[model samples]
Target: MGTNTILDMRGYRRPEPGTQPAYLFPPYKSTLRRAPTKPLVLLPHTLSEVTGPVFGHDAISPGDDDLTHANGGEAIGPRIIVSGRVLEEDGRPVPNALVEVWQANAGGRYRHRNCQPHSPLDPNFNGYGRVMTNSEGRYRFQSIKPGPYPWGNHSNAWRPSHIHFSLFGPAFVSRLVTQMYFEGDPLLPFDPIYNSIPDENARKLLISSFDWETTVPDHANGYHFDIVLRGRNETPMENKR
Candidate 1:
């Protein structure tokens, strides 16, 4: 096995209470149907779950990490840079972690056909990107800021501007999913998904902060969002049932 093998079996810390969303958060209407009706059967992580399936740089094509330019023309909207580190519970770097993101365009519509047709689509933005974290555990991408979109979760329920993130650990089974919200979106307070996490501080971890250092002059603004795989301060992950 190579040095990048993530086989340390020290075991991950259980997320502190309220740091993660409940499987049955009623306000997030989708969970009402999908949440398990019975107690979950815990599965132990074996060798297959903890190691192998490495992601190398060869999988990344030019501009794969830059959503704004990946589809040829620049994506429409206010360009922004999102950068962060993928850290372990103890703050160790997770090198070569595959971080993927997808989101709606500035018009509050996703590129998928299932998305509502109420908003105009930007021909330039497919709104998907992936990058491998560096040896220092840092990853970055450039994209237009996503816009809020109304959903059927509640009456007049418009989702906050956000980006969806998926991180793959050593194995495919270790993949974790979460969302990143902008620092000051007013819609956040009303978003059921955002409020699903019971702890105020834990919910705050999902919001990215503006970063002057990463902001490019006359180009994209910057936001920094560090993701902790697990710990007392872990980012709220989507409930997996």
Candidate 2:
């Protein structure tokens, strides 16, 4: 890795709102009542909330970044390299961030009990992985491409192939959990979870592009994905007269 790349800070991704249709958004026949519509009331920050629950990752497993071999043998799928950097809204690197990732197997099957009967679980792949940012605020993972799976959100709702990423940055407020999708995934247009994002550009931010230069011969295909924790500024919303 060379000197950390200073990514362009223009048009950063928009944060996820609580009203996304697949998970948070409430519908008419939604058994759970929706939260009362109200403007967000920003409160003063507290010392306790600011600094608490520090994690010690000294004993992190060495195999954490290699999901395919973490269990024992190689997982059956197309091998690929997932590389990215964690940066702040101001284009500063956020070194030492803990990134936890989980995904379905190459067959689009999770190891969870709920999915046991439907999709065969790969004994060679448990589908969980993690990595910490290096001095340059960069991290990499060696894993197989996850497959798409169907969710009965609608008549035939199939989620696109994606990897779930949980980022724990310096501050408690910097903790963010988001899903990263691959570029040109045909299922993106039909998936409710992917389409929940209202902004097209914001949705594009969640997708990763393949990097031919990063591709290693006879090793794994490389995909580049950079995460910007938050935006530097927020456009205020005011009621129209």
TM-score of each: 0.88, 0.80
Model 2 clashing-pair count:
0
Quote the positional error of residue 114 for candidate 2 in Å: 1.2
Best by TM-score: 1
Tens digit of per-residue lDDT, candidate 2, span 1-241: 3332212212223445632334344322232355445665653223332343455667357888998774567789988899989998778897888899999999899888787455677889988888889888899998899998876566766779999999887666567888989999999887766676677777788999998967889988999999987543332221010
**TM-score (C-alpha, index-matched) for candidate 2:** 0.80
Which pairs clash in the backbone of model 2?
Answer: none
Instruction: Please write out the lDDT profile of model 1 over residues 105-180, one tens digit for every residue.
Output: 9999998878888799998999999899999999999999999998887789999999999888765455689999
Model 1 regions lying over 4 Å from their true place: 1-9, 171-173, 231-241
The pairs that clash in candidate 1 are: none
Q: Which 10 residues in a row give candidate 2 its minimum summed lDDT?
A: 232-241
lDDT of 2: 0.74
User: Residue 92 CA error for candidate 2 (Å)?
Assistant: 0.2
Computed on alpha carbons, the lDDT of every model, listed in order, comes to: 0.83, 0.74
